[model samples]
Structure formats: C-alpha cells, structure tokens
Target chain A: MKLEFSGGVLTAFIDGEIDHHTAPSIRETIDKTILQDKPDVLRLDYSGVTFMDSSGIGLIMGRYKLISSCSGKIEVINIPRNMAKVVKLSGIERLGRITIKED
Target chain B: MKAINTMKLEIESRSVNESFARVAVASFISQLDPTIEELGDIRTAVSEAVTNSIVHGYKEGKGKIYITVSIFENAKVTIKIRDKGCGIENIEEAMQPLFTTMGGERSGLGFAVMESFMDKVKVNSVVGKGTSVTLEKKINGRFVTKW
Candidate 1:
C-alpha cells in the first residue's frame, strides 16, 4: 500500500491501485526517499503494478525530474503489457530514459 | 455478508499521481495468479477508472478523492473510485462511447474501456452530489488464498 525501500537502490514496492487517489503517496515516498537515501539510482518495479493512465505518465515524469535534478538515474522494470501500452503511447520511450523490462 | 477485503486511500487532486495508484493496485491483485491476459484486463480497468476520476470527477479543481480496492478470496477484485464533485446529469449519455462532454478531446472511452476489460462495471452518480464507479472482475482460475 506504500513504499518499501531497501538496499542501495530504493524500491517503491507500491501496492493497491495507482491513480489520482493514490499517486501522491508514491510521489511523497519517492521524494522523501530521494532526500533521505539520496540513492544514486531509482527503480520503479511495475511487475506488481496493475493499472495506469495519462496521469500516471506525469508521475513518472515528475520522478524523472526529481531524480535528474539530484543527478540520479531512474529506471522502470517489469512493466505489464497493458500499462506498457499507455507508457509507450505517451512517447516516454522516445525519451529513451525510462528503462522497461519484462518480469 | 462477508467482510470486504479492501484497501482505501484519500488523495489530493492537484499532484499528478493517479497512474502510480492504479499500477500499485493492479500489482497487488495480480498476486492471485491471474493469467497474463487477465492481468492486462485488470490493469486497463484500473487505468480507465482512475482516469475518469482525474479528468471528469475532479474537473473543477483540486479536491479530495477516494479509491478503494477489494480482492475477494475467489479471485474477484472490485475497485471503487469516488469523488465528491459536480456529478453527471445523465449516466446513460456519459456511458456511451465517444460521448465525451469535454469538447472532443475526451475519448469518452473511460466506461467503455472499463467494461471491455472487467466482468462487471457500475456507476452511481448524482447531478451535484458526486460520482462513484465500481469495477469487478474474476480471474480465470481459482487459487489458494495466501496472506
């Protein structure tokens, strides 16, 4: 339901659904982690993630901005097919910054 | 008469984060061992529901939104997203695909997408009170419940 961070890599093992109703928690968790751990890299594992919309794009973009500002890299792995469709449609892949991998 | 297995959250409308919420909930339900296609369906349904709330439910401005996700032991998960904002005047018209009231930019496919992906979809709305959407789906097979 929230963020579970560990290792040198801070992973947000997000639970429940991610939407306008649930994104702020993720944003806050990521922001807080960035400030605290200052991890060199951030990984958003979408393997467990279920749904996403255009608003989800903004969430990833915001994190990209946050991590980039801190001189850190952001990678997205284990994305599902349906969710991937939306992400690709957003042209985020064109940015070539979000690293998507299968689970 | 069974206790609802649900997780609830209240979120702000200003910050962009609904996608994260949708994905998170989908990930949780996927643990029930849904097939690849079933997983996709769940994800799409969640996305459509969340998008509707963000784009239509809270269109006026920033406000509080409620999202609840429930996974039954039978591999049927229900997601209820609610918002207290200007409600739709006609549910039937709004449910129509490509019937977006927001100019033509709105795909008007929110409910359609949800129906296409989920087993059951229900919307309850009032002209001014608010709107509540409930989406339900049953995974292909059964699984031993693990907590």
Candidate 2:
C-alpha cells in the first residue's frame, strides 16, 4: 500500500490481493496513517488491487469506523470490476462512496 | 463429450497458505480458459474458504487443509476445502452475514462471498471432527474447452 497526503485527503494506493494474510499489514499501515494525519478524506485507490475477499470488507469497515469517529470520510475509487462486485455484494457502498475510476 | 479430472492439495493451515491455495486453484482451473471475471470469482471464493480454515477452523494450532478440485467436460468446476479443526457449532448461525465470532475484526462474510461467487455452496461440519465447504461454479459459455 502506498499512501500520499494532499489537500486534507489521504490517498492510499492498494496493490495486490487483499485477503486475510494481507489485511493486517494493510490495516495497520492505513490505520497508523489515519491516526497520525487525521485527514478529512481517506481515498482508497483499488486500481492496482487484483483480488479481494471478505477480509477486504472488514478492512474497509474498520477504517470507516475509525474515520467516522474523527468526522472524516472514506472514498473507494478505481475499483476493478470483479472487486467491485464483491464490494457491492458485501454492502460496503452504504458505508462509503465507491467510484470507478475510468481508465 | 464428457471428461472428468480431479486434483487434491493438502497444505498446512496457516494464514500464509491462503494465497497459495487461491493461486493454485486458479492455476488449475485456467485450463478451461476462464475469463478474468470468472477467474477472479473463483480465486475470491477459494481465498475465503481457505482463510476460514486457517483462522476459525484451526484457531489455536496448526492443522491440515485439504483442497480438492474437480473439472468436468462441461466446464463446471467443483472445489472442496476441508480442515480437521474445530468445526462450527451452528452452521445456520455461522452463515449469517456480519455474524463473526471474532468480534468486529472479522466481517463474517466468508460464506456470503463464497455463495455469491460460486454457483453452489454447501457446508458440512461436525463439531470437534472437522468442517468441509464445497463450492461449484460453471464456466461462462464464452470459455473454450481445451481438454
């Protein structure tokens, strides 16, 4: 995961598969960034993500709760079509905005 | 034409093997020339099933996870993930979305994701004995039959 903070938004470029094995590191990295930076918006860019399972849902939910506590927002962008389906099926869109970044 | 092929893999129930399991199954199914979407679905479902075996099934110590993949001439694939860990006590309750026993850390959508991605999902478990999750998906019509 690559992170950049600009204009009160922390953009996280998550690459590779997001599963139980990788979620913890991703979570810790993102959580630490969120806690320290306290950005108004956390934009998660998923274009580089090849695969994601339910663990990705948990990661997103956990971030949503953390950001919400600080009055911040979460935006999921550039989600791959297949990953989008899993996100939608998990009903994660209700917790945050999911925008497909056009290629 | 009818053809049947079966392959079984046994791996240690560790979190790291989750990715290995998915990639192995995905590679095995590639013979059907599945689309990216189809491959992603199968990979996601396999990851979920294997993760469940490692995290919830064998919570305390190391165990063995068995993955069986069967491919049919009609391009239908069946995957069975089994573990000799602590089987679920309540199958019905466990299938519920967002009902994880691991508190808020787990989303409890493992079964949900499997059901969504696969054509059929069946869970058979006997507490203290083990749990087996069977997933089946038919390749899209656009797929080519290589074998």
lDDT of 1 by residue, B21-67 (tens): 56677777767777776776666677676667667777848777788
lDDT of 2: 0.89
Computed on C-alpha atoms, the DockQ of candidate 1 is 0.12
Off by over 4 Å in 2: B1-3, B141-147
DockQ of 2: 0.81
**Top DockQ model:** 2
Cα lDDT tens digits for candidate 2, A1-103: 7999999999999999888888999999999999999999999898998778888888888888899999999998898766777788888888888876566
lDDT of 1 by residue, A19-74 (tens): 55566677787788888888767777766665554445556767777777888777
Q: By lDDT, who's the top model here?
A: 2
